[model samples]
Target: MTPTVIIQLFVFLLAGFVGFQTITRIPPLLHTPLMAATNAISGISLVASLVLAGSNQGLFSTILGTIAVGCATANVVGGFLITDRMLAMFKPAKLEAKESVA
Candidate 1:
């Protein structure tokens, strides 16, 4: 592989490690807020992926961009679902019952 490719791979791996460590260190109480913030970041990534996928790049780039779009879309949706579930845990039972009835 080229030097540029090697450098890019190294940076990606480093970023992944740092992100994983940072996320793992957060307390349970803060996870909901952090997840909400990450969802916004994921939304931005989804938009960027959309642009990349729509651009008239080479076939390989188009395929990779499409994959990125799919992954980012899933991340955004999953994040919201998890966040909603987390928030649900904090709701009063009476409020939940009223919402369910309505």
Candidate 2:
């Protein structure tokens, strides 16, 4: 691989490791808000992936971009789902009924 590719790979791996460690250290009670924030960031990544996929780059880049788009989309959707579920646990049944009736 080229020097640039090697550097990019190292950066990606480092970021992944740091992110994993950071997230794992957070308290469980804070996960919902963190997930919400991460969802927004993932949405930004989705847009970037879209741009890369549409840029008419070579086959390899296009494939990687497409995969990135899929991964980002899944992350955004899953984050929201998990956040919603976590928030739901804190809601009283009466409040849910009241909201549903409105």
Candidate 3:
């Protein structure tokens, strides 16, 4: 393998390790914002799908791109639902006064 590929692989592994450790320590509330951002980015996959559809490749490329967008949509939705459930598990109950105000 080329030196550049080896360096890139090492960098990816190290980054993945650090990201895993960081995520493990994140508070439940942080999941809300993270999920929102992830969903936004995943939505961008639709544009990629459109671009792929307009390309000269055969039916296989179009099918793969469509599948990619569908999978991304599922991932974004599932991620948010999971994050919401996780946050619910950790959320503190509101005081009687605060509940009454709402």
**lDDT by residue (tens digit), candidate 2, 1-102:** 999999999999999999999998999988888888888899999999999998888998899999999999999888888888899989999999999999
Put down candidate 1 lDDT per residue, 1-102, tens digits, no spaces.
999999999999999999999989999999999999999999999999989888988888889889999999999999999999999999999999999999
In model 3, which range of ten residues has the least summed lDDT? 88-97
> Evaluated with lDDT, which candidate comes out highest?
1
Q: Model 3, 7: alpha-carbon shift in Å?
A: 2.5
Residue-level lDDT tens digits of model 3 in 25-83: 98966877777777677778766776786685999998887787688778778877877
Q: Per-residue lDDT for 73 in model 3?
A: 71
Cα-based RMSD of candidate 1: 2.0
Error of 2 at 73 (Å): 1.0
Q: Give the alpha-carbon lDDT of every model.
A: 0.95, 0.93, 0.78
Task: Point out the worst 10-residue segment of candidate 1 by lDDT.
Answer: 53-62
The global Cα lDDT (0 to 1) of model 1 is 0.95
